[model samples]
Target: MAEGVGRGEILLRPLPCRAPPPDGAPVTGTLRLLLGDQLTRSITALDGLDPANDVVVMAEVQAEASYVRHHKQKIAFLFSAMRHFAAALEAEGVRVDYVRHDAPGNPGSLDGVVAAAVARHGPAHLVMTEPGEWRVRQMMEEWRETLPVPVHIRPDTRFVASHDDFADWARGRRQFRMEFFYREMRRKTGLLMADDAPAGGQWNFDAENRKRLPEGERLPDRRRFPPDAVTREVIALVERSFPDHFGTLEGFGWGVTREDALAALDDFIAYGLPRFGDYQDAMKAGADFLFHGLISPYLNAGLLTPLEVCRRAEAAWAEGHAPLNAVEGFIRQIIGWREFVRGLYWHEMPDYAATNHFDAHRPLPAFYWTGETDMACLAAVVDVTRRTAYAHHIQRLMVTGNFALLAGIAPREIEEWYLAVYADAYEWVELPNVHGM
Candidate 1:
């Protein structure tokens, strides 16, 4: 996808095509619950899965999409991705009981949906990857009330940092900042490292990466994924379900499968990475992407792994296709800042969400929703966000996010706004970026 997620060609795929298990497969295995973000099959929760006896439950209930009044594009992207993942599992001989948003008498919550699945399948137990959001995890904690079986929540291994590992790194530190943490991550992953040293003898080159897009420099044509049958259907459903949502449902181009995500990565490295380090922090009036990789959504989703993305950048540097600054900066975000944020998020929560170090108290202005502000930069960023559900990091941090903080808007309100609008926002990732900042 473009920065946020930019252009890509839509590779349409229907639900799984493989035949189901034997006509009378025994219902002996525990039911596996899959959330919208946990779309990969490599999840620990699915290890040793039994296609003959176990059932996989994936749902698109109204409760989630409506929980924050998410952008119509975000809702459509997740639902469409979930459907494709479920279908892929069914093709692999796993029995998947997918509940649609429009399913009759849908209970609207994960607990409610899982309980319904239990009644239909009569599984002995439930297995799930730990959810990303604290609020959702709180609900999972009380599942015994709704489910007849015991529930087991496994750690999500998609991230390089586990809860314990992150806590260990942060323990007994008097003053915490990302630079030291990032250095340790570079050592831990061996990314852009040589013989126990950073490849460039520097931890970060961000200071040198502040150049603006030069005048008359043209941007690469963005990769746009035209919606196919499945995506078109999802777009229509989102339009009907979220008529009042903030952003437009038209021009939806996010990649919903593993192949599409890989294609997105290739496109970025080919055209974006060379210039990314030079102008990463620069902003143009109407350019939403510039040289940034819009692969964060794919990375956050199970479609692509963070470590792998970093390795790709490292490889680009090693092969001399990209400068060390460019490669190191990109890798640092994936392995360093991203991991640090998630670690801080888990270590500091269920109190993190309530953090307001500045004690700010104000409302997010109406301009955020309408992109009608007088500031040229802000209005342009908001206009792009309204159309694409994305704005580059500068637009987010220096424009809208900065305005909210300077105006003393409540953290919770702004957090909700970010969560509602970005296609890549999940509480685990979005809350830390918002509240911790």
Candidate 2:
């Protein structure tokens, strides 16, 4: 067994130490608050925005970045994406009040920065899409009561199902199984549906998607987005500000803009989807991503919406570009598993985070962070995670997650590691996944 470390005892590389309030100006029309994840242009918070009088607030704050010692690449990706999104809004004549994480007199927290923006712009109301995580939602609720202006928390329309929609489906049910929810989503969206029936006359092809990789099986060359000028600058900032954070920024190829994210989606549909189903669950030596759609980070970051991605996959199937099994499996992941977990999160949070069903209390092993271990599968997954800040679902579930479970690692410790290590991980998604495992 690997040596265990105490909770919050993970060593760091050591970094420089690092905020305040502002004065009030005349009240304006609205002050829109855009979190890093709320990068979509058509988000409800930006609805009916007035460029002349209203201002949008986007910030890179210390409190969010250091909340769990996030991966360096994850920080760079979000910060760069936020910067690009802000610039896009500015180009469209929307006035944006952006706060850099390294800017002088930064408030260093989401609420603090929003308060400062309220004082400076003095808007009549604050508008924002509801946050994904329960903790952040609680913070927004506090803002509603404490802020001097009215706050309008809009539903994040990017998701296929709203919280109420999920709650309605989950109401009085004895169990919350994803397969049943997935069928309902299929019926609701009419994706791969034929009149009143599923396209393949079935709800799931998951059993067909579990084949192991044959000898010398070929893989697609996944697209990589080279960091542009804005991304480069953000990378430098993260390197300087968070020298102690996990994961390296060496091979950081994730797209940091909407356009780049779309390109990635197209690339996956063309090259990765056809083979994705057969080998999505198959793991091989030295193959980090085998026919996997490497777009989760983009999806989670709001660069790509779940509905659009599912539609594209459906289109590929209709156009005969990919097989039905692959398309169905991919769609299920987004609309079925992804949506179900999100709904379950909102349904059971604030209590769910503390539910340790197995009561596993072993500390996380040091190899999880360093990838130094005799177990090849665990070592490989951790190594790739440290280098690229990514791992496919199977690798996460079967290797690292499985090891933690069997070794009896504490749920909170492993949960923190999952949240800290992956670019796509957020509390809303990560907590449910880790808790389930």
Candidate 3:
């Protein structure tokens, strides 16, 4: 029964294998699990990848996609980006077990996928970088007792700030504001400050960034990364699968590959950075993107690290090509407020989601789906969101989210819409920003 017919001959074995005894089974190999957001090359789990023994398991689980009625483009972005990453790993001769959404007996969630992969591979240990969402982390921990392998969740190396470091800075603080944290970050990273002090004797140049669109000030032509074959396929699949979902795919111009994301970052540095600070908080009626860096999609999807972005802004500052406020405001967003909000999210999650300060429980307006709002600003942002699946911070915070907050839209409902629409609206960042900011 064990003998093969010939060299290179195909062999079919019985499907069922006897389950080994729970306590006596030996741990044989290592399994590294990567969630969708952990798509960057700088992750720690890939440091010691051995093509012969190690298996990298990445899955497109239904739990993630169905958590909210995700936008057609958002789903396409994550799945398409993940597939691209998997292909890159395979090109590097790295062994990868990618679980597609349509695979038979597919796990409905990440937990189920991890269990199946561990059982199939019979690995000794499970390695992964820490997940951003608390719920995901809890499920992952629960899998440790259920799975036969020891799970080791390592700190994500993508962020410049550490949990312990951020906690220490926040210790004994009264009100946890992003401004104070931004200053500390400026000192720690030496990003846009002179001798641990904010440049130009001001911590924030937000006043400079709040200029509304002048009556005749016309915006230059916006930049975009045209869709490639993979993205086009993804758009078609999304249109077919999620016909009822909001958002248009006709103008779906996003960077699907890492190289494209880098090009986008460079373009923003050269063109967008000069006016980014000036218009960071401004909103215009028909302008989709007004002097804003459209790099959030890259930053949120793990294609670009926050540290690298801050460094780029710093380089611009050193060259005196951009003003202190512009460079500083942009850098603080990457290094300061982003991390501060993330820390707050982790510290108060599962409870924070339930907070309704204004007791808003209204359904998201129907206009959010169709971009049919009376206000010209909402119309513009929503139209852009529908077409491109991308919106700058002002559009998100002031135009869309601000309207939701002012109109007393339910936090949960608003969160769902934001999560569904924007390519960069992941739970970790979107939740707090929607809830409080």
Q: How well is each residue in 123-238 modelled by candidate 3, as lDDT tens digits?
A: 66788888877777887788778877678788877876688777887789888888888788788877777786677888888778776667787565656677777677667766
lDDT of 1 by residue, 1-437 (tens): 11011101221122222233354663246678888888788987787688876777777877778877788888888787777777788789987777777766567676677766777666666888987777778788889666667778889999887989888888999966888989888888888888898887888999879997899998987776788787888888889888998899778888888788889999999899988999999998767799989888777778889888888888898899999989988988888878888888888889888889899989888988897778998799888888888778888888888888888999999998988888887777778888756
> How close to the true structure is residue 203 of candidate 2, measured as C-alpha lDDT?
80
Instruction: Work out how many backbone clashes candidate 3 has.
Output: 1
Task: Give the number of the best model, judged by lDDT.
Answer: 2
What's the TM-score of every candidate structure? Answer: 0.92, 0.93, 0.89
Candidate 2 achieves a global lDDT of 0.85
Give the candidate number with the greatest TM-score. Answer: 2
**Positional deviation of residue 56's Cα in model 1 after best superposition, in angstroms:** 0.9
Task: List lDDT for all candidates, in order.
Answer: 0.79, 0.85, 0.75
Judge candidate 3 at residue 39 and give its lDDT: 79
What RMSD does each model have against the real structure?
Answer: 5.9, 7.8, 6.3
Q: On a 0 to 1 TM-score scale, where does candidate 3 land against the true structure? A: 0.89
Q: Give per-residue lDDT, candidate 2, residue 290.
A: 89
